[model samples]
Target: MILFGRLRMLLLRTIAYLVDSFILFILVIAGFQCFLLILGLHPFIGRHLYSITGNELHLWLFFSVTIPVYMYYVTMFNTRAQATLGMRAVRLQIQTPGRMGLGKAMLRASVMLIPWEATHVAMCYPKPIWIDNQLQSPLFYTALGLTALYWLLPLLNLNEKSAHDWITGTNVIQWQVPTSKKP
Candidate 1:
């Protein structure tokens, strides 16, 4: 029963994450398209659209997607809702004994992004992983281990708390909306 309950929470959390990711993905793509459209509208600058490359493109992605996603999580977690749009949709919220302040929220958000950033860094390596017939980068393995640990922590713990929650001393609980019956 306990295992089943934990699994259910895991499923909910996964769904919430997917929902939030979809929201961000759409926003990022739309923003990128809008930028392209604006450039296309300018006769002089339109010709230079194809010139965006290398570090410039990377910088755009970092600013447009990474920063916004991090800020979104940090702000939402610290807000009165104590949940992202996805978390709220699934009736889940993060809580701590005391109010979750900005510093703690930022910490939690940063920890949550570790696996993603690690994986990206590993993939961005100039050399292939099988160089010299050996696993060239340990970073890929580290990222995989982190991803597995983050997913499995909730199941292993009685409280169903993930790595971020444990590190930040926070809890992701199924929120129950209080109902007021009119007398």
Candidate 2:
């Protein structure tokens, strides 16, 4: 396999993430519709999503709509391809020291939720582990500051492994052609 350095890997990761985000957007929409239909709340999907302000159940509702997204990523990572659709598009694959064990893959999936979901605070309002609580300014800024640092930590590392990567013991690398032929 071809290992990519920090800059190249980050560029590729961003592209792959954008592509995956689009896929996720579609999944989220479809899943939301399905969820609405199942709950007889189809008519409320549009407004409810945007106006989730004071609803206590909105937290669980959001997770219900989001679980399939995590499933897609987890399943793709564990598959023989070992890459999501976006990763495949960019000619990248995830690698571990050896063939990734099932447990590692599962843990990687769970750990991935950290940075992926939480890092957006730098660019937007804070989202967090305990979002049920109202976001006071101090807490919001604190989370945003921490998230900014979390996102930047990979840049400080030569290996390009982000916080989740370090926790999960995985790397994103370029795909290698089985045989090189140049005459």
Q: Give Cα-based local distance difference scores for all models.
A: 0.79, 0.66
lDDT of 1 at 51: 51
Q: Which residue segments of model 1 deviate by more than 4 Å?
A: 33-60, 127-136, 179-183
In model 2, the Cα lDDT at residue 46 comes to 50
Candidate topping lDDT? 1
State TM-scores per candidate.
0.79, 0.70
Residue-level lDDT tens digits of model 1 in 1-183: 889999999999999999999888777657654776677742225435445443454454566667888998999999987899999999999978878999999999999988877665565443323232224558778888999999999999898999899899999999858699999
**lDDT (10s digit) by residue, model 2, range 42-153:** 6455554434342433344446544667787788888887888999999988877767767777777777665444433322333332444335555456656665665666
Show the lowest summed lDDT stretch of 10 residues, model 1: 126-135
Q: In model 2, which range of ten residues has the least summed lDDT?
A: 120-129
Q: Candidate 1: deviation at residue 162, Å?
A: 0.9
